[model samples]
Target: MKLITVIFSVFVLSPLTVSAAPQTTSGEIRFIGQIVDSACEVGRAGTLSSSESRQIELKPGLKLDVDTYRNACSHDALPMTMTFEPLKTSTDKGIVTITYL
Candidate 1:
């Protein structure tokens, strides 16, 4: 009985240790958005999706500097301006809104 109990207890405790093990996530601020005209000119009118937003981490009320990204959305001739706020919610995560502007 004692042997069985010890083995069972160890098995249960083993999972806790494994589950508590430190883990890390990998990825960058990824989101899909569209760009109007006014926003592209001044870097506004940009929106990001929540699902994609979760990919990155950010801090609450963290205002990020404007960033510019070029993408071929509709026609190769037309360029897309991607704007978003980068925030740091964790030590290894960041959140940003990517949109076509």
Candidate 2:
């Protein structure tokens, strides 16, 4: 009976001792992108007419020249602009958000 008790105690306590040791891991996280300037109003040179929807659609890997939209910055807002250049290998297909601040 004493031998059985000893064996049972060893089995129950062995896992607790093994799990007490500290564990560590290593890896690398890389971010690929760019920080752009604030968006300006689309001017007369913009392709979309006033009656058209505000949304602009583009195929994957295509680039849009925001400069063509011209700078219609108002006196109340800061003068800033941006361009649209999709990554050549990017497969993401959705609405790209343009935040104004």
Candidate 3:
């Protein structure tokens, strides 16, 4: 399967060892992910430019549902033109396209 690169920026609060409280900084941050389609780009991409970053948190063992992509892309079909037709899977009923090198 082919994969695409995704990037994200994050901001977080710094912990203090003294009697002072934690502080947040607007600095360079980054995240990376491999996605199969475009819907994943729109749903998962974000910037740490505002208060939204303060409420966002990252955790280990994250999983994404395929239905999220189907729903988001339902209304907007990506424009494509191929010589051969796409094949649908018998099990999960997914549309698969083949490319040749």
What order do candidates take by TM-score, descending?
1, 2, 3
Candidate 2 similarity to native, TM-score:
0.24
TM-score of 3: 0.16
In terms of lDDT, the poorest run of 10 residues in model 1 is 49-58
Candidate 1 residues 1-66, lDDT tens each? Answer: 999999999998998997676645485444446645322222212343211111121344443323
lDDT of 2 by residue, 28-74 (tens): 54454565543453432345454322332344453332332323333
lDDT of each: 0.42, 0.46, 0.29
Model 3 RMSD in Å is: 22.7
What's model 3's overall lDDT?
0.29
Q: Is 2 or 3 the stronger prediction by TM-score?
A: 2
Q: Which candidate model has the greater TM-score, 1 or 2?
A: 1
Per-residue lDDT of model 3, residues 8-63, tens digit only: 11112222332153344587454445654443122122432222211111223222
Which pairs, if any, clash in model 2? none
Candidate 1 TM-score to native: 0.26
